[model samples]
Target: MALLGGIKEVPANQNSVEADELARFAVNEHNKKENALLEFSKVVKVKEQVVSGTMYHITLEASDGGQKKVYEAKIWVKFAWVLMS
Candidate 1:
């Protein structure tokens, strides 16, 4: 999976299930950072077939001192790689 940016090709054997799993894993990994305050983050949207791959929009929600905050992250998965910007 590509973790940064740029165009990437999706492999013929790749399927939506695998792509979704990878996207979820990537989001989990990202949320594990020390500065990450998000809790129960999940993939809210998956936009696919626009350019031979899938685009995931993840929603992260957190509570800070009783205040709720939300954030969005975009991930592109193609073939055997994942891209984030």
Candidate 2:
């Protein structure tokens, strides 16, 4: 299945599976920073149709010392290629 519309919000209870996986990836890639933790907050699309070659907007949150900060990130996804592999 293709990644459809981006995740609009991160639920208060627990994160979506997609978010969890992405969070793990982010942790592996960026967890070394001191005094802060980064989390994937939401995913949005730059255009209407979130198709095989569409770019997605990623919303992230960074928490440090009980305060939180936010950021926007972007990435291109190739669903067909990923599904094929």
Q: What are the TM-scores, per candidate, against the unseen true structure?
A: 0.38, 0.40
lDDT of 1 at 14: 46
Candidate 2 has what TM-score?
0.40
Q: Count the backbone clashes (under 3 Å) in each candidate.
A: 5, 0
lDDT for each candidate structure: 0.52, 0.48
Give the clashing pairs for model 2: none
| Model 1, span 1-85: residue lDDT tens | 5545443445534454654565556556666765554344333344333345656554445454456666555666676766889
Candidate 1 clash pair list:
1-81, 1-82, 2-82, 10-79, 11-79
C-alpha lDDT of residue 75 in model 2:
47
Estimate, for each residue in 1-85, the C-alpha lDDT of model 2 and write its tens digit: 5356653333444435555455445544565654345654443322223555644444556554456666555545576653553
How many clashing residue pairs are found in candidate 2? 0
Global fold similarity of model 1 (TM-score)? 0.38
Candidate 2 C-alpha error for residue 50, in Å: 5.6
